[model samples]
Target: MMFGVNSKILDEIVCILSKDTNVESAYIFGSRARGDFKEYSDIDIAVFIEDPNKRNMIAVDINEINCIYKFDIVIIKESTSRELLDNIKKDGVKIYQRPF
Candidate 1:
């Protein structure tokens, strides 16, 4: 378990996210990814999906795992601005990816 987060928790989160066919990938960012979280720090997650319209659906599925921990979810599209995507890619820790 990296950054004090339980592997099982990450596994469960990945499992839940994987259920959504629209989701292409998911990453953990912010404090959690940086390994410097405080007591009340929230998990920052970035999800990449093929269909922007399905973002809300993916968020709902992510929220279902919120009981395990507080988290903020950001949905990203292929057309998302390069700057933001680059920042996330540089700092975020990838946690899930759809199987081929």
Candidate 2:
């Protein structure tokens, strides 16, 4: 039910993303999270991880999982600007968090 995205598909996405050990958390933001998406709107996701080097690879892996929807992956690192992190925290909807 996330911005017209199928719940089953979202579940599958979560399952796939969870396989990445470096992913500390994931959030949905932008139009999809706000519920104002158009038919062509891309899915926006932000992933928080400790290792910045793994960002690109993680994005590639997620993109390879499915092609039914367009995805924009934003990788958040420990060194990310506080302002940007705060903005994301305020506007994003947390979709997944790895178990401690």
- Measured on C-alpha atoms, candidate 2 has an lDDT of 0.80
How well does each candidate superpose onto the true structure, as a TM-score? 0.81, 0.82
Score candidate 1 by TM-score against the native.
0.81
Q: Which stretches of candidate 1 lie above 4 Å from their native place?
A: 66-68, 78-83
**lDDT (C-alpha, whole model) for all candidates:** 0.79, 0.80
Candidate 2: minimum summed lDDT over ten consecutive residues — where? 50-59
Summarize candidate 2's per-residue lDDT along 12-73 as a digit string, tens digits: 66886788888888998888887889887888888888677753476787787664788888
- Model 2 error, position 49 (Å): 0.5
Residue 61 error, candidate 2, Å: 1.8
Off by over 4 Å in 2: 54-56, 78-83
Taking the tens digit of each residue's C-alpha lDDT, what string does model 1 give over 1-100?
6746777778778888888888889999888888889766787889888788743666666677635577788888666788878778888999999999
